[model samples]
Target: MASTTPQGLCIHPRQMDFELPDPLPRHWHGGDAFKSHLFDAMSLQFPDGERFFIDSVRYFREHIGDPQLRKQIRSFIGQEGHHSREHQVYSKRLRDLGYDIDRLEGHVQARIRFTQKRLSPQRQLAATAALEHITAIMAEGLLRDARHLEGAHPTMVRLWRWHALEETEHKAVAFDVYNQVCGNRSLLRRAMLMGTFFFVLDTSRGLVHMLKRDGLLWNWRVWRGGLSWLWGKRGIYRPLLGPYRDFFRDDFHPWQRDSLELLQRLRGEFDGAHQAEEANGPVPS
Candidate 1:
């Protein structure tokens, strides 16, 4: 099973009052419909998804005895709370753009409700840990690669980088909590399987919905280009395959990937900007 969280690790929330563009561009990522909708699909899932993550980790807060773990738990909750609120704003931007935000969210809400009602608390926590692993790897990918956000709008880029920074900060919190409360490798692996299925399914459904609205769903050129961008050599997600598969190992831990250097590098960039933002007063909403 996974070891305790890495030594000297600390988690804290950052306020990133992102003022997303009033009317978000339909093709915000380099004017590519597939790329923009893919990101939009994931953003639409965050408000509710972050809440579920918070509740799952909170359910086991009392079970943890380590002082540091408990402190990290509080910060984790705060960080995810910030993510949920910011993404709710992002979702509203999508709504204003005429995408069916309600319909996309309803499907995720129904699944969360069912999981809470039918699954055990341990299972719920396992799912949270599994999903966290997924996000953590993707966050690391975004941070390590400037190519991922190349040509994106500046404000949107800032918002995503802020999110990625925090995600990297608390990447291990849920995993540590799960390991403390229930160290069942079998359960975790199963959760990964189920969680990956729904994540892909929901993201694809939302992507399709937005593309259809934009009248690009049937455009073969868009699919051809997007698919190449995602799966071809040097693709944005191509590097993440190994990290994603590492979750199934018997001794897997989030820090085994050893991203502390990258984390510190970004902390300098984002923390400096955040301090400046505070000094400048709140961003005009």
Candidate 2:
């Protein structure tokens, strides 16, 4: 099992720029529009969504008694801020592809703003913890299966692998903050229930729009490609069912499912890849 101790985690905020050239296909992941749009829709929310995560945790910084957790929170904020900036560029690239990405992102921001105005800080913090769990599990799903990202744009794969690894690294920061400040299991569970609904609803709505725009909404082959990606043993989400249900456990913690070995393996893989790139001639700016 992964250590639940905060001291074992290293939260680093990396600033990265992925050059997804114009030559890349609209269906960047596995060359399937459905799969690509599914991720694209999720990317649309990351910039503002990450800002909310940062704000929610920082709001209760005064309540934290542990110095280690306080440091982790700072790292978490820095990491999420950089993630937001990177994904903003990613979502904008979809706009350059003629999709209505900005409009969907605006809608997502509107909902977040509405929640901020109408909800209690405690509830907002609970919502952040809940969503963090969701992302952690989704990240786990991706990291577990190397083949899950097979045939994706190389830069997109690197970007997502980095995101997933960091998500694993700092999965517990917000939840730790919420627990230290305002953890009501019943209230957190309720927020998770509703949050799950809206998360799916919003992503699906934007995905449908993107699919329609790509003229893939009615394409049977496109949907088959999506089904193949989302169903069966190879599916990224099928394993998430167990982890997602674990969120409702009485003493739930993101570190309960130990995938530290997987993290270690990927870290080595990515490190060696980066070293090889460095050894090569200078990459084009």
Per-residue accuracy of model 2 over 1-285 as CA lDDT, tens digit each: 222753455565555677765554788887778888888888888999999988888899888888778778877887788788888888778888888877888888898999899999999999999999898888888888876688888899888888887788678888888887777889999989988998898799888998999887999988887877787557768888988999898878887777767766666544555542231122211
Top-TM-score structure, candidate number: 1
lDDT of 1 by residue, 224-252 (tens): 98998888898899999999999999999
Q: Runs in model 2 with CA error above 4 Å?
A: 1-3, 269-285
**Top lDDT hit:** 1
Judged by whole-model lDDT over C-alpha atoms, candidate 2 comes out at 0.80
- With candidate 1 superimposed using the best TM-score fit, by how many Å does residue 254's alpha carbon deviate from the native? 0.8
Quality of model 1 by C-alpha lDDT: 0.88
Q: lDDT values of the candidates?
A: 0.88, 0.80
The residue pairs found clashing in candidate 2 are none
Q: Could you list the CA RMSD of all candidates, in the order they appear?
A: 3.8, 5.1
Residue 262 C-alpha lDDT in model 1: 83
